[model samples]
Target: MTFRRQVMIILRRDLRIEGRSGEAIFVTVPFGLVALFLIPLALPLDIELLARIGPGMFWSVTLLFGMFITFRQSAAESSSQQEQLRMLGVDPAARFVGRAIASALLLLIFELILAPTMVVLYAPAAIPGWPAIIPLALLAAVGLAMIGTLAADITASLRSRSALAPLLVAPLSVPLLVPAAQGLESLRTKNGIMVPTMFMVAVVLALAVAGVVTAQPLEETT
Candidate 1:
């Protein structure tokens, strides 16, 4: 099969499984919402304070819960299922991209739902720069998805993968978190987002390259 075909098949298969399970929508998203809802309660009831910190809080929650979405599908796969894909001659790089894309889509949904909730709850003084917010969210989603996918792959064979995956993902995801928070803050401040936006793009590109390069070796090891 062609690489593109392999990617599509894997992507479709993963999405189908997630759709049926509703783990991302029903489970992860709610927990994320709850987390976001509780943040302001923990802080002083100062609206300005909440507004000022809202963007950072939103991105922080996203990075935390988004990692779970990346691992959710992979953790559900059995050894037999993985071996079956290998037996069918699926390319490891294609598998990597396919899973990353699926994770990215799910994370995008998570971010979309949380964005409005944050806005409603925090009510920041400045209107969000939707023009910048849209692409910033997309880039953040892709970057987090890539980080989570690679971390899941690295820990796939471990008995402690559940614990280890988060450790691996969180530190590595600093590049994504800092720039994403900065971009959102820039939106509020009317500051140009070029530097942070470019940094996020670079992080996504770097992760994509790293994922493709390491996929085969990781597959072989596992």
Candidate 2:
């Protein structure tokens, strides 16, 4: 099969497996809700503090939850002999892209479920131009997906690797997350609107490129 076709086949198979197992939602959704719920409880009932920090909290939680989910999802490969199958004929680059795409889709699903919950629990007034939040969410999720997928691929096999994915992904993710928090916080503070968007876009593109480039090594290792 052509390389693109092979990649698509891998994506389809992963999707089918996730659909059958229902592990995708089971893993991401609950954590997302917990994240939303915790923000309120952790901070004192000060409305100002909650409003000031809510977006950063929500974004961070969503990104983190997505990373954990992606790690588990990608690590599932080791549970079977699929890694060996890919070792033979598969183009490692294509496989990496395919896995990244699959993880992005899962992260998107988690965002849809989590964002509204965050808004409801924390109140939408905290975020100005609340409808414009979609781009921010998408940008953050994509960045997380890139970092998470790459980390997952790298750490899929070793018994302790799953624990390591977050350790690695989180530090690499801060550059992306800081801007995301700033962007959302700006929306909250009614400050400059453009800064976060610019930073987020840059981080998103950079992480995507890094993920694709780094995935090859992990693919070979797997």
Q: lDDT of model 2 at residue 82?
A: 57
Residue range with the least summed lDDT across 10 consecutive positions in model 2:
73-82
Looking at candidate 1, what is the lDDT of residue 218? 84
- Model 2 reaches what TM-score against the true structure? 0.85
The list of candidate 2 runs beyond 4 A from truth reads 73-75, 124-128, 188-193
Please give each candidate's TM-score.
0.94, 0.85
lDDT of 1 by residue, 1-222 (tens): 899999999899889889889888889999999999888888878988998888788899999987799999533567788889889999999999999999999999999899889888887656655567677789989989888998988887689988999999999989988988888667667787898888888889998999999999888732
Clashing pairs in 2: none
In candidate 1, what residue range of length 10 has the lowest lDDT sum? 124-133
**In candidate 1, residue 191 scores what lDDT?**
88
User: Deviation in angstroms for 72 in model 1?
Assistant: 0.5
Model 2 over residues 110-196: C-alpha lDDT tens digits? 888877777677664644476565777778777787787778776776788867878998888887778766765676678866877
Error of 1 at 71 (Å): 0.7
Q: What lDDT, from 0 to 1, does candidate 2 have?
A: 0.73
Q: Number of clashes in every candidate structure?
A: 0, 0
